[model samples]
Target: MTAYAVAHLRPAARLDDEVFEYMERIQSTFAPYGGAFLVHGTTPEVLEGQWPGGLVVIGFPTLHDARDWYESKAYQEIAPLRTRHLAGDVILVDGVAPGYDASLTAARMREAQEA
Candidate 1:
């Protein structure tokens, strides 16, 4: 199943020089894990309640890939920079896979009618 990491951030102070450098270096981390940024610092058109500041949505081929990227030592080292600079919510979400109608409700209903 495809997975996404949704980050809704309210910006605080800018990252320190060291942290910024670390951020720049981490780009190499994604390719190995089959992860890529879908949306990075793109301003959203808020149609609902109080809009959180910065939002980033990263995509991964699978939930495992996303987890690996998050848990990896490379990311863990710089994770604090992200937390210190932005404050809000970040979460992983699993998506439905292809051809997932396992219930076969229509077939069940048709058989019941015939019976």
Candidate 2:
């Protein structure tokens, strides 16, 4: 099944540049693992969490791919910046199913669109 990694970053004071650099590095590293950024720095309508910060969601071809990217040496090198910048929580979740039925999803989408 495809997997997703959701990162909630509460950037440290005055660490925007550092965070940006780290994200750049992360993006570069993701390519080899077949990962893509689904959402980066999106704000939640309801902020109920104790930690208020940036949110990043990454999609991977598989759970193993996501895990590999997270644990890779390349990512480890810049992980400190992420930790130092955000005093928040990071979570990785596996998607519900493998290989979505695009035709079905498209039909649903069209229905919703027509509605």
Candidate 3:
């Protein structure tokens, strides 16, 4: 299954040299794990609620690849560059398979609740 690294980054007061450096070096860390940016800190169109900041999404070949990329030394080294300057949330999640249905999830949830 495909996996994703999703980040919701709050607005930075300023983009310092460190942040720029992190941006410059981030792509290098991805190639080893087959990670690619699906969305690179892009401002989203607000259809419903107000969006606090930009969204970043990286797609990986699988959940293991996503985990490996996040835990890899290269990424760890540059993570602080952004962490120190930005406040946000990052999570890795697996994408649903082809022909997935919400009804299947609903059935599972119903069974769990009954249990």
Predicted candidate 3 versus true structure: per-residue lDDT over 58-93, tens digit per residue:
999999999999999999999999998888899999
Compared to the true structure, candidate 2 yields what TM-score?
A: 0.74
Worst 10 residues of 1 by lDDT: 14-23
True-structure RMSD, every candidate: 5.5, 7.8, 1.2
Candidate 1 to native Cα RMSD, angstroms: 5.5
**Best TM-score among the predictions, by candidate number:** 3
lDDT of 3: 0.93
C-alpha lDDT values of all predictions: 0.80, 0.82, 0.93
lDDT of 1 by residue, 1-115 (tens): 8999888878756556755665586667666888888898688989988786878888999999999998998888878866665578989899777886757767888899999
Return the lDDT, model 2, position 9.
69
Which regions of candidate 2 are displaced past 4 Å? 47-51, 98-115
* Candidates by lDDT, descending order: 3, 2, 1
Q: Estimate each model's TM-score.
A: 0.75, 0.74, 0.93
* Candidate 1 lDDT score at position 69: 91
The TM-score between candidate 3 and the true structure equals 0.93
